[model samples]
Target: MEWSKITSDKTALSLIAIVFVIFTIEGLFYASFLGEDGIINDVDYTIAEEDAQAHWDEYKAVTVNVDNLRQALDNGNLSLKLLDEDVSIIIFESDKADGYYRGYANGVAANQAEFSFGENAFSCYVDLGTHSYQIAPSWDIVDNKMIYAVYMTDYKKEEQRHEEYPIDPLTFEISNEDNLKHNISIEVFNPSSSLIFSEEYSISPGEVIVSPDISEFLGKHRYVVVLDGDYEFEESATVARSTGLGSSEKLYFNFINNSEYPMEVGIEVA
Candidate 1:
């Protein structure tokens, strides 16, 4: 017989063959037990599961509530637009409240607006009231908690009426508690609706001061202050000048807190 190649002994060759057969059988058993794709596939499946969990963790649910959609029925409209492909809401008054009708402004304001957006950023625009402007609020993802609150109303009714006055240096001061850390921005717009001055400040713990001389902008200017903090904020500001209105010193703006915080403003005409 042509002997199979073994080191020296036929008995040793038989034993080696037996050992090879046993190893082959063991390998087949292991593979068939977990199927053909066994350990590698299990590892891949675990990685996929982990990735899906991370994706769900990052996803956020955002809501926009236009409180007074009925106010825009006569003149304006309101809408919410999500950057994603699945959500939108157009607001109109479908139901009555107190004495007024209010609901989603569907066609008049926008097309499709919804309360659920599984993303971080979206736009909420309200074209309500008799004012000739746009009031669009933005949403952001802050601290892994993604909830945005918005209140829409008639601009003519909600805007604070400010008496025209004069001052040389426009002084601004913002105060917040120690637990708050954010930014506050101020913008000065002229009567022709041009941005004359704009500045942003980083606020951490205490009070900050911002003084600007807007001597060139004479009459009917706007001051828009925006704060992005997490705690109670108190805004104190005074225009340092002689109290009088001339052709070159009257600044008039309805201060609107359109930031991401609940703001309270106390204005004094000096």
Candidate 2:
């Protein structure tokens, strides 16, 4: 072949390869934004929302079967029957100085663990690979001899398969339980750092404030709350998606002011 002809052929092949790569990258970039029903549009959002609502309804309709009449153990694996499954359990030792519990599930160390209090009662957090649960006793036990009324406050199955859809209209419910009025500032942003909603409210004692429905904006976003007062607040927020409908799936940031000091709390909601 002639030298010029060979060079021209190489140049043409290079141009075709560049075009192919550009189109492939563009296709993938758009594919990342596609919704569950293929195209990303208002109709897709409505269909996904309706399907999610149906799942929530079915989950709510199911009867919860809990066996709380089991005996408490001081330490070691405690097996309990829940929903017809032999779920392995581990009780947090109260004597730990750090207030952190470490234990094994199915012969493997738990991935995550924590402890919290509600109404002055103890709550346990355990993550066992595909399953995570928040368990608590019904009543305080004097010793390990008491029959602990254990119940699951939260349960998540990581192995369960499901279609991905963004749950829209994240509602923010703020309440001032203290005797004094509180000026609370609330803000929500999208993934692109754009301010989608922002509002400040003066909430009085025994008063509650609810934010407007947040539509369109989806994916992991930032939620922030600032209380304009010197008060010690406890953040009781859960980012977990609920199996119930409406406000049940909303990310709740409960601020319990017990002291006179200003504080701000921010969390990411998905």
Go through the candidates in order and give each one's C-alpha lDDT. Answer: 0.32, 0.37
What would you estimate as the lDDT of candidate 1?
Answer: 0.32
Ten consecutive residues with minimal summed lDDT in candidate 1? Answer: 18-27
TM-score of each: 0.28, 0.31
The runs of at least 3 residues in candidate 1 whose Cα sits more than 4 Å from the true structure, single-residue gaps closed, are 1-167, 229-261
Query: Per-residue lDDT for 1-270 in model 1, tens only?
Result: 111211223344334431000000112211111212111011101112311211021111223333233343323343333222122234344323222223343344433232211223222333322322221221222233222322223334323322323334554345544355657676664322345677877766555454566533222344555444322211222223243432222222122323322333434443
Off by over 4 Å in 2: 1-77, 89-100, 110-115, 136-162, 167-270
Tell me how far the alpha carbon of residue 160 in candidate 1 is from the true structure, in angstroms, after superposition.
Answer: 33
RMSD of 2: 24.9
Could you give candidate 2's per-residue lDDT for residues 1-270 as a string of tens digits? 111110113344344221000001112112112222221111101112322222221111011112221123344445543322355655545434433444544545554544433332344445556544443332222222211122222223122312333334556566555677777666665422345777878877778666777644323345554556322122222223333442223544333455522222333333
Query: In candidate 2, residue 36 scores what lDDT?
Result: 28
Which residue pairs overlap in candidate 2's backbone? Answer: 230-260, 230-261, 230-262, 231-261
